[model samples]
Target: MLKGLAGLKAAAAKPNSFARHGVATVLVTAATMALGLLTGILVARSIGPEGRGALTSVLTTVQMLGWLFAMGCGKAVTYTLSRDHSAGGRLLSTWTLILLPLAGLAIGTGYLLLPLLLAAQPPETLELARLYLPMIAMALLSELMLGLILGDQDFRSFNALNFLQPAGVAVVYVALWAAGRFTVEAAVIVQAAMSTLVLAAATALLIRRHGLARPDPALGRKSLWYALRTHGDVVGGVITQRLDLLIIPAVLSAKQVGLYALATSLSWLIVSLSSALATVVMPAATRRGRSGRELVLNSLQATFAIGGLLGGGLFVFADIAISLVYGPSFADSALPLRLLLPGAVLYAAAAILLNGLYAENRPFTATLANLLGMAVTLGGLILFLNSGGILAAAIVSTVAYTLVFAAAATLYRHATGLPWRVFLPDPALLAALPRRLLTKPSPVAAAPANPAGK
Candidate 1:
């Protein structure tokens, strides 16, 4: 009977624990989305289109550079730490050592490229990028540390850290706006300051909870090789994701960039859901040896259902939502938002499939799909540049995402032999959500095998 109780406890903990984490991730992501929208509204309304565009460009540049410089160390750290608990300290130390030099290289490159890249922008925008570019190095360290937390599968802390910085920035931005001090520089500075605070807090917690070790060259090489294999895909993915935005300043006006950025920002809510699901999927897949078809299918159904509803809503209410949130000046952003909703959902699906590939230890395969997607994006952008403005950018983005999803899904099939039908949604999976919440675990039916009850 005691064994029965233990069995029940374990089963209850197993699925229920994952369910709880999924629920928390969804809730946190929803809250973060709301907070993010609020921040966008506040910033956009205060700065107008040109200023908002400048701020948006700076932030995007910082993030893209940070991820590029991170060189997949963060992901490598997570993958390594998830599989080998004993090597946590060495993994963290090695990745940190590797990231530092890369960070310097990244920052230097950004400095060299800034003049050429931002020369098209207004002087104010260029100045902001110059001032804030240094922060990406720090952001890289923060991201690596966050990756460590994720490796530990401490979703609670991960969710907290994810929300805290945005929440802080929102609050601080509101205060600054109320005081009539919310210039582009002020907004960017506030974001950087809040992020730094979060980073410091995260670093302290990581050290206290998961202490550090000295760098080991051999371990560093192993992690570096792993990061190299994985981060190529990461770099390609990031480029495809942000290439449109990067090109906007060159071919379009700051106001047009602002409108497009606003739409894209709002559309990322769909992407966020995919990312949240993937957070659970990756570590869970690692444990299961492979991301089985049923598992991936179930995740796909959930993503599609959630994404469909959100994307549908955004499409129908694009005008009203944009007007109400960002004011009438951003009314032009509505069509682009509508255009991006479907693509964002596709992007989300691709992300989950891509994560499945990672869990299967086939990072290089994922790289090919991502590079193909980036190439498509670039080609589409060039093709559409002269004729179409923000609208063209939006449509091309959707096309790029569709092709990327097809590429990733095909590779996933080759890797796992999963059928295409699994990607479709089912009412049964949707119904499972409530059932999981209401049902109680059954007791064990039999005892473990033992000879003579020994």
Candidate 2:
């Protein structure tokens, strides 16, 4: 069995088309996950439940604001730059210029609102929220840098920075705690410092490698418009994903909101795994025509299988995992985690399907699916929040994602003229693929080469 597994591994690494890039991405993802787990443990140990809850609330708010400012341009940067390198470079510069002022405005807005929003909270927690708001804003620069690296397909640099940023923040926080300088305010300061350093380094590297000497203003404008259209799904999708977080705080008590936040954090692991696969397959998917259908089907199959396995494991171990990482103070979160687990798995599969639509330039379809999903989620949450508390929130969120996934699969079939049946996962078919993987040598042929190769 050991020799067979070794042989299978060798076969998997034969440098065939997407497989080569996929293998590399898997390595990067593995490293990122490892570092992220360590960072999570450190944060849990250092700050405990209250700190974790505060960080979750602040980060969720920041994520929504950052998504709004970027306008989904980050994903668009990758797709656009991959299609036209020179044009992409100019667009990247333009986007950076546009985002700088926007980031400032967002930071100012968040800072101004912090006191008003947290006025009712405990004095210490309110103070912590205010201290963290600026750090969230500072991280926007790092996010922009990430967009540029992804646009250029510099996954090596991107992944390195990905691991570094979180790990750096964790290490700084731990060091500060060890030295008796750790406070919620100090943690925010450390976060700001790390974001500044990473953003500067990433921006400098990307500019040195891919920056246009004199970017054409006309080209930049055109690329910006095109990117907006191309990335509409991403913009809508972010709003849809974040709706519960954004609204829950308004409707629920701080403690209830905190429970929902904890559940959402657990769900994020599903997304992280899905994102790893999507990052690997996106470039390849863009190069195909009819063959993209088969690629999407195959990807969904793998994603669903993996997501199901992991989600199930998480569900089974939810209480233990929550207690271990977050301590017994957060035991209230276990049931919410279980409620969201299946939905999280479905959300993961949906993400890959949405990526497929984006590759096919069917952003309209993707956007529609996301909007519909958001409607379902919000409507359900409103109806249930009054009757049932955090559990209702989890159930509604799961239902929303399931609907979204179904919608995406339906739209993908309609757009590509692919049969709806193709969306369904067939365990028999997947079981049959291993023999083909071994005997055929190549799992799939290479996507046609594009001149840009951004």
Best by TM-score: 1
- Tens-place lDDT per residue, model 2, 304-406, is 7767877888889989987887777678989988988887888888888777777776665677788877788768877887688788888888888888888
- What RMSD does each model have against the real structure? 5.9, 6.5
TM-score for every candidate vs. truth? Answer: 0.91, 0.83
By summed lDDT, which 10 consecutive residues of candidate 1 come out lowest? 445-454
Tell me model 1's lDDT, rounded to 2 decimals: 0.78
lDDT of 1 at 381: 89
Which candidate leads in lDDT?
1
List model 1 lDDT by residue over 59-91, tens digit each.
Answer: 888888998878777777777777776677777
